[model samples]
Target: MNAPEPSAPGVRPEQEALFSTTAEHYARFRPGLPGPAVQLLAGTLAGRRAPVLLDLGTGTGQVPQALLAAVPRLAHVEAVDVNRAMLVQSRSVLGPLLGGRTLRLVHGSAHSYTAASGTDSVAPDLVTCCRSFHWMDRPAVLAMADRVAAPDATVAIMGDGSLWTHRAGWTRQLRELIQRHLGTARRAGPADAYTAPVRSYEEDLAASPWSDVAEHRCPVPRTWTPQGVVGYLRTTSFANAGLFPDSRHHDVFERDALTLLTALAEEDGPLVEQAEFRVLLARRPGGAR
Candidate 1:
């Protein structure tokens, strides 16, 4: 029953600002969890009836939204995020699903959020952190999960590589074009830069309370048109339209990116992005951390 704290230590001001402004684009273009991944998480709760889920860094409620659609036994979801705009976008998209089930949207970081103080607040059967786990303090969040998770809870960390990391031929060309217009270096939020992780999520989880981890990967093939590629770029942190130096520059970049995609698609068919979506499940040992 502790009060929620301020932002966690891992939160960067620039990253927060970047995500806060791109809610609409994010909700529109970012892909949801794959069906197999959702099934794998839900499978961990086979006997639990009406399971409750705690989704940390629930950007636009994508994980919960997809789970609710896939897992009918889910009764409630506590969606937590630091960005208000992203939560707003979540509410807008998840409106219909909120009818019969309980969906509580909390404004807080993953390491600090808890269900509202009351006897009714249930310990979650599944704790999920989707693509937003990279932005969190892994140890702190895992410790927090240890405190709040149910005896048989499973902590699911899921993500697919972003467009920036994809190695498709057209994607490489597109990245080069972006670098030409912006700079050779990757652009993150204003005044912020991207760095490769010193430690992997697997390493971080291995050191946490939930160390008995199992990984599941699925091949998620995505096809995109030129316009779809442009839309997806606007949602990414590095290539967000807002990150451009000026409106004119943003427009020019978009135009050029579209042109590149169009040419690639003309030579081939729809630009297909081959991505592997991975989910790492860490369960509490013997019904306890």
Candidate 2:
């Protein structure tokens, strides 16, 4: 997911800064949307001869990487992100996936992305935001999509719970350790606190141009190594490097977390999570693809 653009108002500063320092870890450790989720996103562009994708908060190009492989008619992708480092990382990771197709990386928040987003001329067939919609100014972003999206375009708001939100014995213990270091309140940014959105994504879309919606859920089982678990935490809002008081605090937290995860992995066999990857397929009520 992409962060906040320093200029875009109405979004939290913490949202923009969540994955800033851990760009590399995010590019490496954050898992892509499963096969079923990608296929559902692809299905939206069913009849378009050459579909263009506008991936808002295109962190490390995960949405495009999955969709490009699943939808061959997808010829161009204009990926926007708030972090330059993430865009740099995205370029490298998405390079191999583009078989002579176009993948343009735009540095801006989803709330900030527009038709004149530098070289981005994306009147996209399908607009996607994977693991990223929560970080946006939802109404503003939908309005932007309304202006820029092609006729009959589909907007897919997709995400899954993070390791911090997962339910499991190891996850419970891991949360406790994180709380011990960062406090009980989940940290969303440096010096900034976390809070729930005033409206759900569904409610936000209901009041926007994309009023009609359908949701799809894919249950995915995942296993993680102790090291993999640590890396994923390094990219999360509650436990990234930014939340620590100092380098020593971050280091100690990592050490303690690894120790905890290793023991759990040994005794429980695997550090596992049953994640529900969800896609909210929204389109304007009267529009038909």
Candidate 3:
């Protein structure tokens, strides 16, 4: 099927399929949830009975899985993504966890999701746009989120590995060199600043002037073997297929990534992949400003 016209501008066309087509690997290799982030979300949303949770851009349902595990009592979770492949992976992952009818998955873009139409008319108590937030038309997503969320509902935007800690000596510098040679479009080298912090969730929430808004940060330490590292990068929004049509570049990137990993291992290096996720939980303002 052809790509749908984006709900508006600013949405990347391939972002939808990039992770989806590689759904199995993504689900298999993507890092599992960090304890702090999940605990923070669970604590913030304590004591809600079967509240509806909307998982936006829920590729392979990792974030949703975490949410479900954290809030198993939810009435239902509605997970929407533009990738059917991703939805398939999600079903495989979330099928058993859901209590028969407690889970709903949709193939659609986050910008187009509407709580007042079709199967989503029931507003959600929480809407989460994990890692995929940057791929969205920010303005359009925020507007739609505002419309669909229940009063006092929370919107959480989260991405892991936004910060790269220099726990592994020489890794950061090596990454820079590799990234410099590969360029952004070329997937054939280390991703320098690949996981650098970009947008600030606090700023976004503050700018929106959301009522009862708060920001929380969690340090999620992750470990990956060399092969796992490669697979993990392949699952990224940046590493989407077709971005590097050049076979040579793709070959070189794989080679260099492995070489770097080997050297790190020789040095008895454990890649201390320190990542931080920020959650901007905001309730819809009551009665205007």
lDDT of 1 by residue, 98-214 (tens): 657878877777887766765588899999998878877788899999999887799999899888889989889998998887777787676667766689988988888888888
Give Cα distance to truth, residue 195, candidate 1, Å. Answer: 1.9
Comparing candidate 1 with candidate 3, which one achieves the higher lDDT? 1
Q: Quick one: best lDDT, which candidate? A: 2
List the candidate 1 regions with Cα displacement exceeding 4 Å.
Answer: 1-12
* Tens-digit lDDT string for candidate 3 (37-137): 77766765677766788888888888778877887676677888877778778888888777654666666778877543443456777788877776666
Give the distance in Å from residue 181's predicted Cα in candidate 3 to where it truly belongs.
6.3
Worst 10 residues of 3 by lDDT: 1-10
Show where candidate 2 strays beyond 4 Å. Answer: 1-16, 117-122
lDDT to native, each model: 0.82, 0.84, 0.65
Clashes of each: 0, 1, 3
Tens digit per residue, CA lDDT, model 2, 1-289: 2232334333345555777788889778888789999889889999888889999988888898888888887889888887777788888887888887877677777877765446546589898998878877789899999989998999999888888789889899999999999898888877766777888999999999999999899999999999999999888778989888788999999999999999998898898899999989999999995
Clashing pairs in 2: 4-16
Please report how far candidate 1 places residue 84 from its true position, in Å. Answer: 0.8
**Clashing residue pairs for model 3:** 50-75, 115-121, 188-253
Error of 3 at 36 (Å): 2.3
Poorly placed runs, candidate 3 (over 4 Å) = 1-12, 116-120, 162-181, 184-199, 209-211, 246-252, 285-289
